[model samples]
Target: MSPQTCTEGFAYDRRARQCIDVDECRTLPDACRGDMRCVNQNGGYLCIPRTYSDTSCILGYTLAEDGTCNDIDECETNSHHCNPTQVCINTAGGYTCSCTEGYWLIGGQCQDIDECRYGYCQQLCANVPGSYSCSCNPGFILNPDSRTCLDVNECEDEPCSHRCFNTYGSFMCNCDEGFELAADGTSCIDLDECSFSEFLCQHRCVNAPGSFSCICPPGYYVYEDGRSCEDINECDTGNNTCTTAQVCFNFQGGYTCLDPLQCHSPYIEVSDNQCMCSAENPACRDKPFTILYRHMDLSSGRSVPADIFQMQATTRYPGAFYIFQIKSGNEGREFYMRQTSNVSATLILARPIKGPREVVLDLEMVTVNNVINFRGSSIIRLTIFVSEHPF
Candidate 1:
């Protein structure tokens, strides 16, 4: 054969006169499976199984041209019988099925796992298809870690009027000492101390923001007890408008003005020696009169041992006999007159005055033997003041 004129599968052979078959099976040993027998053909070779290990492969695997079993990735090839929630893993010669994160394998099937039963979340846990998520209850927020829950700070926005307190899963509004929580629970209101207790103030009640103050009415002031009220003396404080001639009398809640008593012109004595008036004078025809007055203040139910009034009268002539007689006014009802001598006399009150009153006394003096043989009279007015308290 020509060197360049050889058939497709046979090389030219100089000793051969015609074309002949080439023993490619013996020359190309790696043309088929490494462990199988190679059969020669007209132009190619065929590999035949020599042993069961050389021709067989385990499940999910196939025999390669090198006579070695190669693992089949059923997960990547989508050939595994695992469920959608399960994962397929490849082995040396086989594949295994397993459940995902939030699922469990049971009876060759994947089932949803209850992660909440295992205390997976601090507050609340919810299961998804293949995973679980953590959540929080009201008034709380989920932490960034996704497993723990944190309390929300409701006081950050100043929802309460006074104070705010935080608790587990919730928040509370608080008020100061003198305040109370409102109906909405987020605000604060002032407490009415006067409306709840009457003993807080003795006279008047004044309510303030966080407290209350006690007040006394007009003409009164707070007492030493700090609660009760006592009457004020307007006279002592110069608060009274009474005149100089008027007396200012203080009462429980107020003061009263007392007017001074005045006598008429005819009842008053203008001259000191009224008994010495001439007979020719028209005043002498009538009885000459002298007036005396005095004022006394005595506590109710108390008696005075001293005399209230004393008088001494002398005539122009000596050795004259005189007689004194109590005429009108009081009629000696509240007083008694004693004649120490013919010219002197003293008057004393019977008892303390029970009430305020004015006493009028009229005394007549008659001279038995005198140059003028005249008669004289004197008028005495006594004012008694009865006070309930010491002045």
Candidate 2:
């Protein structure tokens, strides 16, 4: 039995000089299942089942009855070491940790995420532990979507009394033409147009509620242009108070009276600004004067024959011309006269006199003869009284 070889699963013992069983499980603890026990047999070994309690499992492993330590799915068994806001993932021997929504895993702990860093809000953003909110500035408001801001309408309430204008975050007041906004900014006040020198008023300016009017002084009237003033012609309108013998001349702001009376051969200038019959001249005494009276019936609206006044003048020189006219006292408009020739005429009352009245007719006669180279004139004044009763 010296140096004899043994078969598989057997060993030779030199002292005993025979084949023996080899307990491979005792030398190699990992030769069988982790939960199984190793037993020696004849030339072989056996793996027997072992028992273990729940505590026998490691932190991330489960214990089996064969006394084996297996990998445990802590994610599925709800036995992970992660926070409530963390996600668990099953690994080979343990579970991996990750942060949930709105949170971040930092330094092995869940921390609040700053959503503002991602521009979550249009204007302003506030971050919480796990969420975020949006807000607006002073003159704006949050939109319904909670992510944007909108401007407010300040003119909706109609702040101005006259006119209101809406701005970005406020309101403004305005006024119409010829008006101005008051100090309160809501009311409107009148603008004094007359106070400005740029106002074009020819004469005077009168201020009103919201406008101005131009005024003209006496003897002047506003022109058709409504701004300038023009001189009024009293002679054309027959509004002058001057007598018929006086001529009316219009000036800038007034009128002038011109006396047309002139003294001739048989007449002299009187202190009353008139031409009178000269007592020293014999032709003045025979000034071709004639007077007659007339009557009328008021009830019948009929008048008697007109009064006749005649004057005849004969010159020895040929080409002698005679002229006849009334000098004054014709403004009453109640009397009329027609001259049949240069020296003969008739005077009549236009209507019946309502009461007793006296009428004076001043007549003048002038003669010019080139043959005799002489010019002569005469004046005749006649007075007539008209009584309401028959007279």
Winning candidate number (TM-score): 1
How much RMSD separates candidate 1 from the native structure? 20.6
Each model's lDDT = 0.64, 0.64
Q: What is the C-alpha RMSD of each candidate to the true structure, in Å?
A: 20.6, 24.0
lDDT: worst 10-residue window of model 2: 292-301
lDDT of 1 by residue, 215-254 (tens): 8866678888766777688889989999998878775555
* Residue 321 CA displacement from its true place in model 2, Å: 36
Q: What is the per-residue lDDT of model 2 for residues 108-134, given as tens digits with 9 covering 90 to 100?
A: 466777899989999889998788999
Candidate 1: C-alpha lDDT: 0.64
Query: Which pairs of residues have clashing backbones in candidate 1?
Result: none
